[model samples]
Target: MASKFQGFPGMDDILPGEIEKWQWVEERARAFFEAGGFKEIRTPILEPTELFVRSIGQSSDIVHKEMFSFKDRGERDMTMRPEMTASVARAVIERGLLTQAKSLRLYYVGPMFRAERPQAGRKRQFHQIGAEIINENEASDFDAIALVHGLLHYTGLKEFSLNLNDLGDEESRKKVKTALADYFEKEKNRLCKDCRWRLEKNVLRIFDCKIAECQPVIEKAPWEQFAPLGANFRKLTAKLADYGIPCKVNRRLVRGLDYYNGVVFEITASGLGAQNAVAGGGRYDNLYQDLGGAAVPCTGFSIGFERLLTAIQAQDEKAFEEIRTRRVYLAPLEDCAAVLNVVRETALRLREKGFRIEMSPGVFSLSQHLKKADKLGARYALIAGLDEVSRGKLVVKDLAKREQAEIEPEKITACFEQ
Candidate 1:
């Protein structure tokens, strides 16, 4: 029969086999971030609507079109955050984290909500692992980029490219915005409906439009002539080269967020096709002041957790093997109370040693139990029968080697250790 209900579109249920990959990625990220002196911070999934409007900018796609905003019964405007930077900024300011220290280094992994057309690797409710460095200078921008580069390298992804750009300071951005608006207005008739709207709202966003007809008009819009790179931006590129990090300067790499002011970047892997950007971030120097806090310079980046996993699975065949090591299947052949007791004790002892043991309930012959063990991908099968229980011994069968040995019950764990 058909199910009476269905999951919301763009929302996914991560099943058992697939969830192992997510855990593996999370474990590696936690180790990497902690070693870098970045503490983990988790902000609420919902925030006051004005927070995003002030921080992300009212004209950006996240605030204007994609935000999941609603009014509570208390009549307060609220929104589910589409990204974490704005929320992180609010947390630092509201909690006075920076007052105690000159700077704060933090990392986060969680779900974000956005209302948009969903496709492969893009979901309404997606997960991200990101870091934020607040009250730091231009060097922090390079630090953020290097952190992301190190993370992808740790994940074992071989085929990917990093694209970097500098949006310049606020004054340079203002001049570029005016020039872009003037130029786009002249060719407004040739632009897409969305680009036409963006022209009046945020002219720089037109570069993000993927509409085929808007491509030529966007390509010839004179990006370099308007948003020129400064000395600091050039210094960042030189430092990256000194570190031997391969990065291409893309003059058109304005990220989809409005808050980013200087040095933005994106890393796209091979297997993800058109939606290949596994990670991206940049500096948002003025966001704190915009959100009613002291002026602070900050830089950070976030990796699309789902896209990173997809890339890893495509590249590494044994990616999940670490999670599957030393798994055992325990098969109880008799229904007697004594045999069950022995089975329980053996399973518990094996578990204490960090072995994953699956116990078979009810009665099954030895051959049938071995079949079940193979089906579960168990490396070994521990058989407990009435005779073995009485003798305080169990049959340990190595499924991979096709060998069996009668061993004392206490030695079962040690046998696998070998």
Candidate 2:
């Protein structure tokens, strides 16, 4: 009665009933990326352990606490990729893709592993749809942000806000980091344990701490004094405004990653509560050189696939209805070989016409098959019985209309073409 095994905690299985939403989101993402001239790139799920440490920063949460790292048979350190930017950089450099083009526009859809406490939108193994634009300038930063805005809009997410921040250039970041470190050190006792540890190692990460005790100290940190807004940052905001994309400038928004510099952004949707960030990313100019490639400027963003679906479902229930309709159910009444062939061929032809077809197995009775079709939300059911097979005809029943008609095998697909 009880199962012998269970899935790992925080690792969820996307069951059949729920996976349609995922597919819908993924399809829209792929089409959007392709239209924007971003070629798809898939990197290995695992990378050298040092890659993350070097790119994501050792003091960051992903590298310090959340990474799934271990050694292999040869005792070489390896890690399951917690995020994709590092892996994408490694691929471009290793494959010499950058050598062939002046710039690279690539997108990826896959799972990222992070050993985080699972909540509604967070998971140990989660999927992301992201893109990277390498060897581009500050204008490309605007492009990257706008692209994410457009994609989220395409998903039919209505109530969302785009919060933008500039981490400043490298020199400004160094000054701010030092200022934050010194300021947080004085208030170290008042900070959380994690913030206390980050105070010395990577002080910017303290802003990422969501602990209530640390919020007061983080809010008072001297961000404007050290990293004052620059001209380019103003221009980015102006451009976004010009395009009619509403955004709020958040000086405290230093994204969790250390590699991000210049511009950073996060898009949060309403109704998802505290973990409402559906998408976020910014510029990482030095990542290429840091990972053993030529100096290149890159900007990109990743949409949390699960969170996007949640927001869509909450806002628009009808979005899922489109995928539920136009499905065909095939019911084979006779268990004989000839009837099976006819059922199989008919289903195959219908599928070729771009219809979702579900075939009933041999053991199901005609009544049971009809029940299954209804359960699947199919609009039409094609019943193939001995009499219909002998007459080279199949019974097409419009489940929604409660009507049935005998049509020749060739006319079966034509019945639903309208």
Each model's RMSD to truth, in Å? 3.3, 2.6
Which regions of candidate 1 are displaced past 4 Å?
326-369, 380-398, 403-418
> TM-score, each model?
0.87, 0.91
Candidate 2 structure quality by residue, lDDT tens digits, 113-186:
99999888899999999999999998898899999999999977888999988898888888888887889888
Clash count for each candidate, listed in order shown:
0, 0
Residue 93 accuracy (lDDT) in model 1: 90
CA displacement after TM-score superposition, residue 129 of candidate 2 (Å): 1.0
Taking the tens digit of each residue's C-alpha lDDT, what string does model 1 give over 1-418? 9999999999899996577568677878988999999999999999999999988877788888998999999999999999999999999999999989999999999999999889998899999999999999998988999999999888767778999998989998999999989998999999999888899889888888888999998888898888778888899889999999989999888999889998999999988878999999999999999888988999999999999988877777776676566688988889989988888888899988767776566789999999888887888898989998898889998888899999988888888787
Task: Tell how far residue 155 is off in model 2, in angstroms.
Answer: 2.4
